[model samples]
Target: MSSPRQQHWENVYSTRQADEVSWFQDDPTLSLDLIARSGISANAPIIDIGGGASVLIDRLLDAGHSALTVLDISHVGLTVAQKRLGDHAGRVTWIAQDVTAWHPPQDAFALWHDRAVFHFLVEAADRAAYVRALDRGLRPGGFVILAPFSLTGPERCSGLLVRRYSAAMLQAELGADYALVNQQPQTHLTPAGNRQDFIWCLFRKSAT
Candidate 1:
């Protein structure tokens, strides 16, 4: 059998266009709100990890943030995003690789964003690898925004199990190097019109 994580997301996106994905929104207004409130430089380097076929790139560009990169493990997803952006796509950088194994450039990004990705790392080792990637990819004082399933949220997504977390539990998992600056509860509408609660956390890299 294929790995559950790979199969689940691949099938999820395979049947849907970018707009059909459950997390899809005409505008990720909440995400934009968080970015604006982060107090980071307008020209800071921002990266969307596991961005795949999301509309995040479009919103990021429209906001006038030029130093942008989208990284994902799916080539088909990247192709769709590239097609959607047309010529404007050239202005953004794209990386197709597993986030864990991918080595980012030194002090590469000032902001990092992940939605519906971290919860998929159900195994302890996998989760640790993801944290290590964060350490390597972010610059000093970089901000990280994550939206993961809340402890009280649904147990499954894309037909696979996810590791849910509360704000404190998530911070504990990520460790003391990152200080949680803000968090909010979010209710997302599934294709079936059901609501799934999630915790959106913003963490700033601590000056150690």
Candidate 2:
């Protein structure tokens, strides 16, 4: 039997089209821009947490990034993306697992990206596990780009409660070892024509 968490997302992916989802972005323009500005090499190993069927990987491949990984709890979503990628899908490492419980390969990535996922982790223990995975996966001096619901954003998303964050709160959660590189406020317009506020944070892990 699948966990409720897995089942919830599987159901969502099975029923929704990429364009029908509120999180849909025809082209992740902002995300692409931020990543381009990260100064990492095209060969840098990068991972997209909760990337389920996101076209970001396609764009990255088009941009000539050789190493890419996408992780999501919903196997259905990954399947959709793989089918969409056709033969090119083999270039990507796909992991279908819960982020909180998943173990990271040590120093595996030079940049870690997450969008529309962190806020769903409303539990302290889950958040702690996430941090540990992050620490283990990212190389020293790596970049972490997170887009979370801002304090002014909706209290809930996708019929689930979310933990909104202020810049300070996010910084604290990352600890002093991470140096803030940049931040941008986004007023995202969902595919459904609803508006959601978001804060994009870029941090550089200490080279220690």
Candidate 3:
């Protein structure tokens, strides 16, 4: 028995071709650039929240990142990625769970990356739960890369409402524990040739 959220994603992945999804990207250039900017070691643990069927993990593995974890609410989405990776998938960890309800290991990851996911949490409580997971799962000096719909982006995606954000709004959500490192705006061209605005931010957790 899947929750409404889980069921929605499951249906989406099961019915639609991965590359046809609005968020599909042939090259995750911005995400890779930010991860490199973080200067984490190849062996450092990194987790991608709501990674779904994204090929970012494939790129990370190719770059010699040995410790990689991808968490998505839809099993079908995870399966799509796993199948695409073939045997290489065994080297990565796949977790099928919702970010808001997840209980991640304490200080388990050196970096956390999310793209086009945070904005979907239109509810304040859901955002708080996600932050709690981030606080608990990330190391003291971990890096966080979050990309959400920009203020000028769509108010809805995949038939669900979303909350657009600015860099300041994102910083407020993370609170004082994380220091904003940098931010950039991107105009993403979807598979359907639609343009979507996204704001990407990098933050470092307090070492204390």
Alpha-carbon shift of residue 181 in model 3 (angstroms): 0.5
RMSD of 1: 1.9
Q: List the residue pairs that clash in candidate 3.
A: none
Candidate 1 lDDT over 52-77, as tens digits, reads: 98888898898898999999877778
Counting clashing residue pairs in each candidate, in order, gives: 0, 0, 0
Per-candidate TM equals 0.93, 0.98, 0.99
Question: Which ranges in model 1 have alpha carbons more than 4 Å from their true place?
Answer: 1-8
Give the higher-lDDT candidate: 1 or 3: 3
Q: Give the Cα error of residue 98 in candidate 3, in Å.
A: 0.6
Count clashing pairs, candidate 2. Answer: 0
The alpha-carbon RMSD values of the candidates against the true structure, listed in the order shown, are 1.9, 0.8, 0.4
Question: For model 3, what is the alpha-carbon lDDT of residue 21?
Answer: 93
In candidate 2, what are the lDDT values of residues 1-208, reduced to their tens digit?
A: 7788889899999998977887888899888888988899999999999999999999999999999999999999999899999999999999999998889999999999999899999998888899999999999999999999999999988778999987778888889988888899999899889999999999899999
* Candidate number achieving the greatest lDDT relative to the actual structure: 3
Which residue pairs in model 1 clash with each other?
A: none
lDDT per residue as tens, model 3, 1-208: 7799999999999999999999999999999999999999999999999999999999999999999999999999999999999999999999999999999999999999999999999999999999999999999999999999999999999999999999999999999999999899999999999999999999999999
